[model samples]
Target: MSGADIANVCNEAALIAARHNEESVKLHDFEQAIERVIAGLEKKNKLLSPEEKKVVAYHEAGHAICGWYLEHADPLLKVSIVPRGQGALGYAQYLPPDIFLYTTKKLMDRMTMALGGRVSEELHFSSVTSGF
Candidate 1:
């Protein structure tokens, strides 16, 4: 995250805590702020068919699984199938490693991890959707 992003997250977290009538910011507040920053706002009103939900679950899981297995991939943080942003069916979050420079192998691992979702869809459904 950038310096500005960190400031925004802290500010947002405080707001969330205030909304909940808490005297001080807590882990939950920061978590929500991080999610809001990373995933945009959650669109609770966005509707998905049962099939779509199922597909999204698998697709996100694919990303999580790939990251889990890749030595150079960032550590997986959380995976969600909730509809968020304009058209994201789901997302898999990762906690990027603290490194000043990345090796070529590291970059390749990241690419492989990113493609896991599309490959997963092909494997599971025998076809790929637009995938948001």
Candidate 2:
């Protein structure tokens, strides 16, 4: 099965679980979904090439670093270079305990942090990819 197919299956499962009024979907379910996608990618031999992997790593690392540098930005939760069902080459996840109204400066800072990955990739590699 393709990564997208596995993701769709996971989405359907989550939807069904939610509709059934389950108290909470287990974390194991999410892990299973991720594993399925990763396995599919592996079977397809679509694992990123070395250069692409480095690009993805640096791109994700930029987001985490920039977010950490910003005063009002959330803390970095995780960063991954693995391709997911959502078709993303990488992702940088953050955790903000609370959402509060933002000042203009804060909003700009947030936007800057959000764009940090693309900017860094371009700056470092002298090129940009569709993945960005």
Candidate 3:
């Protein structure tokens, strides 16, 4: 994780511990904190048009489906469409491996998953946009 990510997780873990009247952050606190940090605080107040919502939903679903079936890809944990941290309209969470080196198949699977959204848009809408 990056320095900002570590800081955010620590801060969130601390808050979680305090909320439950605990003395220190536990494993569960860190897990929840990581999820919160990655998924980001939901933009409850953000508004979207129905058409935009449909498009985003489909795009995110495409990513999830692609990751699910791609054998060499990282294990998918979650997917979300809530806008967060500036212009991030959506994201896909994966249980990444620790090692740095990657095999050719792994890279290919990653590429396939990355392109899933655009493929989906083309298949469904017959045209694509750069919003993703």
- In model 2, where do residues sit more than 4 Å from their true spots? 1-45
For candidate 2, what is the TM-score? 0.63
Error of 2 at 42 (Å): 9.3
Residue 29 miss distance in model 2 (angstroms): 9.1
Tens digits of lDDT, candidate 1, 54-112: 88988898889999999999999899898888789799998887898999999999999
Which residue pairs clash in candidate 3?
none
For each of the candidates, give the backbone clash count. Answer: 0, 0, 0
lDDT of 2 by residue, 1-132 (tens): 477777676885576558768777666656555554443342234577899999988888878888988987877867777676556777876766565687787787778888888888888997877763
Give the distance in Å from residue 64's predicted Cα in candidate 3 to where it truly belongs. 1.0
Ranking by lDDT: 1, 3, 2
The Cα local distance difference test for each model comes to: 0.91, 0.72, 0.83
Displacement of the residue 77 alpha carbon in candidate 1, Å: 0.9
Residues 1-132, candidate 3: write the lDDT tens digits. 999989989999999999999998999999878877877676766787887777777887888899999999999988878776556677788889897999999999999998888787777786776754
